[model samples]
Target: MVSELRIGILGAGGIAERAMVEPAHEVEGVRVVAIGARDPERARAFAERWDLPKHGDYETILSDPDIDLVYLALPPITHAEWGIRALEAGKHVLCEKPLSVNGTTASAIADAAAATGRRAFVGFHYRLHSFTRRLLDVIASGVLGDIERVDVDFSIPHFVVKPGNIRLDGDLGGGAVMDVGCYAVDLIRAAWGEPAVESATAVLSDDDPRIDLQTDAVLRLSSGAPVHVRGSFIGDDQGAMSLRIEGSEARLAATSVIVPQWGATLRVSAGDGLLLEEKAAEGDNSYARQLEHLVAVLADGSPSILDVRRGVGTMRVVDEIYRAAGLEPR
Candidate 1:
């Protein structure tokens, strides 16, 4: 029997409650032993609810010699520091995305991972979704031929309404681009394969304390494929999130691809008629899939499907996009 991997979860917040603990409990050969939070009462409550051991400070979990892994569920601003510390402490780390706020901190985290020879993974959860997996397989198979263009649309109307939510504070690494917009950017990179950003432009809300709450940016890839991305946190309603890939032989429409409805079929049309249409199985929660992958990397030294190298590359592109848009790092 394979031994269960011991895991420590940082940040006993909603994201952890929804994305990590709840789903992870179903995966075999994984054990979440400890949960950490800044507030002792909050941490204890979360721990009791999840049936997990409690730690008031994050350092306690990282310094625990028996814990094999640490999950960083904190804000974007805290990712780099905790990631580096965890890696140096001989613990593998799985950090939630954007990896870090900007390229500088991301680079530092990547450097620490390299220097420590530790397994580090990022939580770009969308990539593990069934619809997206199929999309990647189709693109990589060259069934659509040489790619010409890609269009991505994203909008989230109901963001955090908490008065002191880190997502709204620029100093705390808050912004549409860093938070939600990065998903579109990441998808573009996954499709284009190592493309550099040519330029970016953004429009901010009137007297907005944070960076632009909406962004429409055009990216010119080195492969000559141009990507158009639209993202916003404030919208009339939640706009449709989709991706259209135009290639030499035909065009593939991934309508409502981002949050694909379960039991609904995804159609790939060839303009003349339907080419492929299939309903994806809503099996294996993405959080579970990512955790399994992280465990495989730690247990047998397997390569991470979404490792730090990719995380750093994604952050660099986002950093450049911010620079082009005249949004200075906070």
Candidate 2:
């Protein structure tokens, strides 16, 4: 069990900077000391930008005894190989989602973790956000009554114009569903209960039928509540990362559900047909809270919501969605 966790980032991508290194200092006894990438110069530049103590090719950080945990921000195609390697090297892993290109490959990471007695966590940091807690609170209070359905929309234009962006390349494990739909699907499962996909369809890119530019899936909770999820990458007003829960007695809606750090609003309304409750999301970035959770998991035996096993469960659903859409899973 690690008391002080020294982290090495496995990629020099934007997420490693924004999601891992930037929020790391907020967690006690956790420091991002090193970074490694396929390109040594990119890794060195990233390390210098973040003022990290170590940087080099990917093997440099993996072989470092000082790196107790590795946060993998590499492209989805590389997660399984490196996650397994890190676990075998006696280092815990915190991998970015979708964990891997598909569910079957993702399960190997869990297998690796179990065999090595090293934990592997998936980075679904949004679950640690304050709005999530508030959403749960309202549910537990029964103010929303019996849930009737959940609707989620998460889309961004980040890669729409970048023809070479990984998200637009099928070989890089890219797709609208894999990149953003995972969040929508995971959010419902966490905030409510496990769900089973009912039907799904996709709008494939003109250049690549395997690459979904947009995906829409319908799911049902064990409790019989329906879920409508839409993930997009090319359109404005598709679904700007919002969630709504319509219950028998009331309705709850949240804006900016994905990155509440940029500011968010949660509103609940009932029979009166007016706003009954309103809450604002404000707090540390969920990434910091996630790091804290990782520390606790290492210090003791705390279970993690971000477990790779759970991530595999999510990927299975994603794979099902892809199959239902008549496309192949990465």
Candidate 1 local Cα displacement, residue 102, angstroms? 1.1
lDDT string, candidate 2, 44-111, tens digits: 89988889999998889889999999999988999999999999999999999888889999999999
Over 1-330, each residue of candidate 1 has an lDDT whose tens digit, in order, gives 126788888898788876678777787778888888787788788888888865667888988987887889898899998999999999888888778988788888889988998777788876776777887788788777887898777766644333466666777787778877777878877876666666666766454555677777778777788888776667546454667878887777765555554332456667688888776566646667666766666777766667888888888878877777787754
Provide the lDDT at 165 for model 1.
60
| Candidate 2: worst-modelled 10 consecutive residues by lDDT | 275-284
The CA-based lDDT of model 2 is what?
Answer: 0.86
User: What TM-score does candidate 2 reach?
Assistant: 0.95
